[model samples]
Target: MTTLTTTRGDITTEHVDVVVNAANNAMRGGGGVDGAIHRAGGPDILRDCITRFPDGLATGDAGWTTAGRLPARWVVHTVGPNHGAGQRDRGLLESCYRRSLEVADELGARSVAFPLISAGVYAWPRRQAVTVAIDTIATTPTKVEEVRLVAYDAGVHQEIASSLTMATSVRILQGVRALHRRGYHGLRVNPGVAPSGLFWRVVLTDAADPGSSVRYTSADEAKFAGGVVDAMTTPHEVAEQILRALPRLRPANDAPAYAAWFAGLLAAVEPEHALPVSSADYFDDTDGWEIGWNSGLRYPAPPLDADSSQ
Candidate 1:
């Protein structure tokens, strides 16, 4: 499957196999992403457009040319339907992505970067533009390993990637809701603050005691957040709203004296397999006492919450 992702950067500097440009049918050069690519890629691109596509290109169709000087090997140019000019067929908007990918595949491009076609000067609604671009790229069959939806600014980048975080937070919400139905009491969806970004911490607690909890963190690496948010803040408004409407959080460090009680809880929960060692916390006091043993998930790990779907 082609991994769809978002990056907040200049598409011209993208070091991918191909950089898809949202060009006018004239194909020579234009504004926005088109002009940027042409300028960065130098005059050979214009030369290729003049020599190869003498008649320009058809709306919604795509053609490729040499990258000239850009890091990419080729540039796939597609004409997006001008929504402002009354050409509003969404199929044509979707075609910009589909045809670009098709052209990329013909060039055997394993990776490609694309701007949100028509979202700029053409004035296609930004949200709808994102939807069409992702849906078309995802449904299109190709061998491309990675496709980046490149945004020119931090805000646009966050808006594009929020679609992904919405899915993740929803899945997490549903999961905790399931455990709540299963009678698990102490629960939470919290963050582990890091320098780059936050990691997810899903805590499930003992049904009877309601104090002990087993943590399931999303060990995945941090995504590019465009430097807009992290553990202290997040661009995921849906997740924040979901968490706020859920339940009261019980801080995990509240019962540190009982840490040993939940120490072996993970093993008991999954008796069939041994859980791997994870980075945790160690407490120490300088009373001239020798360290005997140490155990626990990372400190300030997050907090637990009561069961509530609302």
Candidate 2:
């Protein structure tokens, strides 16, 4: 089983099978986790990485080095991306975790440690960045038994704690749906109801925190609104409609459903602009959430009212 752990300590002093150095493309010393690992592991680690990975590893790619003075036998060097949205950086960051695990598995290491990649001086907001890091770890099918995310400060620690909360929220939602399947609820969306052509559910949040309250709406509404706005005979007509819908939202945080729906809608609407649709690509996102679709395995749509058939 894979487990998530948090700690704050020198990666070198921590007694583990491997310590992952949140590294840079050069594999040389810079700041943050990179500098720390290079400083503790000594200059030889850098020299070895350079010799071993001469092609200049891309951001999110990883390589390995001897632990040097660090307590572990090997140090996996992974380059995380700088913070950005839908930028190539996101892909690179995902690659960082994927490559690191690959390196660890190749070495047959059972345990590994990671710093909050790109969340420090790299300017990735601690909250958003940590989610991506944790999500990447959770979704990977690698054989490592334990993965520790070492948070260096209170801010980073809180971020990791929040990730835990989000994961819990997901579990709770699953439980709710499961209970409904067992006839535990008075009003539940029938799991048997087949999805109707890329429906979206957007949850708007006032507080950005994962645990905050949220308001939900169907994506069909947004699509209708867009069409209405485009068709309005006068500017006032569109503005009036927007104002009428404004009060529907109260101050609250968006639930995970919001993000999941948006990601899916984007892919469904513009497949070219979205990330690749696969277990590998879905795990690559910060959400660490997975959704799949198959033409032959679909449930019957609304009128048919039949359960899914594989």
Give the local distance difference test score of model 2.
Answer: 0.55
- Whole-model Cα lDDT of every candidate shown, in order: 0.63, 0.55
Model 2 lDDT per residue over 8-126, tens place? 76666777778988777676678877788888889888888878888767777787888888888889888777665333356667677878989899999888998878876567766
C-alpha lDDT (0 to 100) for residue 64 of candidate 2: 86
lDDT of 1 by residue, 57-130 (tens): 98899999999999999999999999999989988998889899899999999999999999999999786787
TM-score of 2: 0.57
The reply for model 2, stretches above 4 Å from the true place, is 84-88, 174-310
Which 10 residues in a row give candidate 1 its minimum summed lDDT?
223-232
lDDT, residue 117, model 1: 94
Q: Which pairs of residues have clashing backbones in candidate 2?
A: 60-96, 205-253, 205-254, 206-252
Give the Å error, residue 192, model 2. 24
For model 1, name the residue pairs that clash. none
The best candidate by lDDT is: 1
